[model samples]
Target: MFKTSLDKFTSINRIAVISDSALGFGSPDIIGLADGLCAHFGAKGILVQPDDLNRPLVDINFTADVRSVRLFSDLPTYTRSWRWNFFRLAARAVDEFKPDIVVVVGPNGYGASRALRHRPKLLVYYMLEMATTEPLYADLHKHYGNADIDAYIIPDIERHNIDFGNLHWRKDVDFEGIYLTAPINYPVPIKPRAADDRNGKSIYFGHIHPEETLLDNMLTPQLNDCEIEFFGRIGDADRGVIANRIASTPGKAYRGLQTPEDLADTLPRFNFSLVTWKPEGHIGRFHLPATKLYHSVLAGVPIIAVPNPLNVYFIRKLGIGLLMDGWSRRSFIESIQAAKAMIGSDAYRSMVDRCRVAAEGEFAWSRQVSRCAALVERALEKKWRRLYGPRKSQPALAANG
Candidate 1:
């Protein structure tokens, strides 16, 4: 609907985005930014999601009218299968659309290879979660192909030196700067608490990846004090067990899926938010992009993140929220104790103020979509630069090979 309606004022030649399994892609943070960019920039955007993954999320997709955005499904059987289908359709999309650039919000080397072979300009956005403590070991020399593809990485946890490389990835431009992906671009239909609804409680939400489930015991002590509202799709069977136990506990509410509007009302009542655990792996350490922090920030609540590489790095920079060392009960308790001390202190209020600032200025989708649009525009320019460059070369790599 949006794609067809957009031709009068703007012309988005072509752009591509693929993030999750279903591909409705309308999360409050990322998709909101992407859709807003396409609309504001007068560019047409088509999101590619797996058919199997998309249908169930129709309600979520519609929450912000993202269902009206253009989309085509060539979704596959499984993730590995999705890769094959994704690249193939992506190639066809590029060929048919004849887009100025091909983009993937996450690291997509396979698509990069195709985009490079097809023409010249291929844009890749690497959303970073943790830089120093978390480690994502992609073969910089291998997966990245060559230096022609401008790489922009951020949430700049490991700014100075990290796993990727010391030398700047850009050939001549400084495209690689710290960027904070905005939370979803919801219409703000619901108003937050009118200041009297604040209640003290520690809560966390988001994916409960297998490795991070180790921290469930920490809540046993505090589950009795206040509503320990735990929400999210249980990642796996064992994680479900952990979630079920916590949810089953008295006073701990497992308030199932709440719409963005519901969250606006419900979240403001909670005094503290939780961001716990880092999986002991590459992807876990380096990239933990939790929009919950932005949610907590926006809700006027502080995040109680685990004391790991990611949280340590964020506090030192963004200066928002507190950290619990280890997902251990002692650590969580002590941290909240520290938080209580600081809550009445200047530092805590300042953190709350900073969170609100980030929610409006740094974390909101309105500003982020524009920044992303700029990046997209720049990436397309670079692509064109290489496509029509004096010496740009194209080597046709095997797609299904």
Candidate 2:
């Protein structure tokens, strides 16, 4: 029931966002969007998220007053206990903040929605991934069935093509509502790339779960083309495996986790950013727009990856990256070697230039938030009309005659 008008409306004054995802691994898109909306409308933003005591905080800007409600300080990550805490804390936040709109982060925020269902606030779901997998699919479908949900926001419009089997979303639900595509926290004053910025390296700057993200033991036997740096943390359970993998690998180096500021600075020094998934993996099932890919593009570095349909489409279309040909060990080496060769070429600068242009033009966070703002306005306008009839216009003066 969302209006698609991009018309300006002053209905949304204050926004309350609850990032129900884990503290460190959460997608920064929702938070970034909220920041942009607040900046655009000069509205107050109250962000409720898990405590960030351990991880380095991401830098963001808000226009008006922003009150952060850090909850479940004792919980390190997503847990069963978080569900209960989210409901209680979110209800308290809404009641206290008295926001005009409440933006819930993911499917986990269903409890928070339930807490505020009786209220008249606009409820928007910022769905991170589109999964038609077994358990998650069922849970997501059920969540979509919630009658109180005003709008559903997916990261990309391309994700709508994913096979959902027999599962379907609510007919009245807003599906083609808002497309974040790939969101990035574009560095303020946009960093410029210099001739000396290419440090002859490729880097991977995200959570480390080699078992799921990387090929089995490929780090050691493969990844031989260029110096590959790993700049993110691994979970405790996988540390032993990851450490052994790094030790066995020749060119691979674990740089550990760096703060957002440090990471942004470090990214510009690299020639390319890594965006890998299993050759015949389930990564395509979720159909997410990779945040790091956009970050690398904005940093003026090409993305190197084995082709997922979405990745291949964007990478080739944007001319910002390369997709490997085959899935075998030899093919993998050949792909990395090709990337290294291109990175060293004079023509590589052209590719880097295209990346920067594409990022600033197509993948801009401002454009995403503008669309989001329109969606919010339309939702609020719907509510306004429902409660207060059609807006009245002034009567015409005396006729010209």
Candidate 3:
């Protein structure tokens, strides 16, 4: 029956990707996937989002033919105004592109989904998080439960199809196993490094803020050997704290923002990419993989992350990184010591080779987009068959994740 239904139609030729600038213009990984999807299917891409006008579409890598329709105003503070502006923009984008499939990124797609309620086009919920045991996840499930989306292209595979309390009863939204981590276009060559390379010469390339006690702890004299290079916006409240921390860590430098285009070339110069959450803290509730994970993976740089369920899954699954026991001074020192030993070892070289393989195969944006494209074709065919009965077409196909 599944194959029969999917055989009713052909392929997806056009796609519209909608994102919320309110949520900080989405990550570069998703934007890369969007771009790859357009190229892979030969599909015209129509991107719609809330616009700041002053800045370029931050974190997005769009192609020339991919039309961008940005609402020329700040996202309104008032709830009603926000909804009104979003719906208006969504309507305008639909009118302009008249796309075959609409890809809504994150929660920003809520308004767009409502706007496209009566339209015949298929809506894809390109989700970032999965509703697990957390209350926040339950709320997310409620949102998805109400949205009239046809398919889901979840990035993290481990989070898919898990029971979401009462929300599991709804069978309308099809779970397509299309996933993405980053656009691994090519293998980033790993530079030869000294055995002590992983000592204190690590890189941390994401949001810099207060309450990140791990970074604060790294400033201790006991942790001096492992200086971290920071590259992201520092939180206002933590400005003084970060300045002091950088001052103490002699070799450490806060390089500010680095564009995604330069990350592949820049990151391989560092020993490893740092990733740690507040220990036993509130961050453990959600199951979203940090964007930095993919950035490091794509660049052939291994990750040094505090052991969490999601972090453990990714690092172990790919054999591409090391997981610290905790954020304690002892933990950090021990992990770095282990890193030092691993550098130049055959095992380390193997790990780097594994990362390169994983990047091009499992986490490559082009492959993931191809998988999503196939899902779109199948889902649209199924929907059409249900409404108008089967029509002759090519055989149904599926993609490996």
Instruction: Compare the candidates by lDDT and give the number of the best one.
Output: 2
Tens-digit lDDT string for candidate 1 (129-234): 2222312213423444435545453454453234345333434443444334333325453234433346666665655544554445545566455455766655
Per-residue lDDT value at 13 in model 3: 66
* List of clashing residue pairs for candidate 2: none
- Model 3 misplaced stretches (Cα beyond 4 Å): 1-13, 22-26, 52-64, 75-84, 129-144, 157-169, 184-200, 279-286, 390-401
TM-score for each predicted model, relative to the true structure: 0.72, 0.83, 0.79
What's the lDDT of the predicted structure labeled candidate 3? 0.64
lDDT of 2 by residue, 1-401 (tens): 57533232435678888875544333556557667777776888888875544654444544446666666556544455656666677777776887777887765555566666346457887766544434654565555565676776776655544523334544465543443433333324236476346788888887677655664434746565467888877755868777667756878788887755577678888887878655344534435566777778878888887666667877788888887664456666776777788866766888888887887788776677888877877776776566565667889898897
Candidate 3 local lDDT, 128-236, one digit each (tens): 6544445644665576574466778776555554443356645556766544464422222223233234443578876776455366655556656656777766666
Task: Report how far off residue 267 is in candidate 3 (Å).
Answer: 0.8
Model 1 steric clash pairs: 22-53, 28-184, 29-183, 29-184, 50-75, 121-383, 134-285, 134-286
| 10 residues in a row with least lDDT, candidate 2 | 181-190
lDDT of each: 0.53, 0.66, 0.64
Can you give the lDDT of residue 342 in candidate 1?
60
Order of quality (TM-score): 2, 3, 1
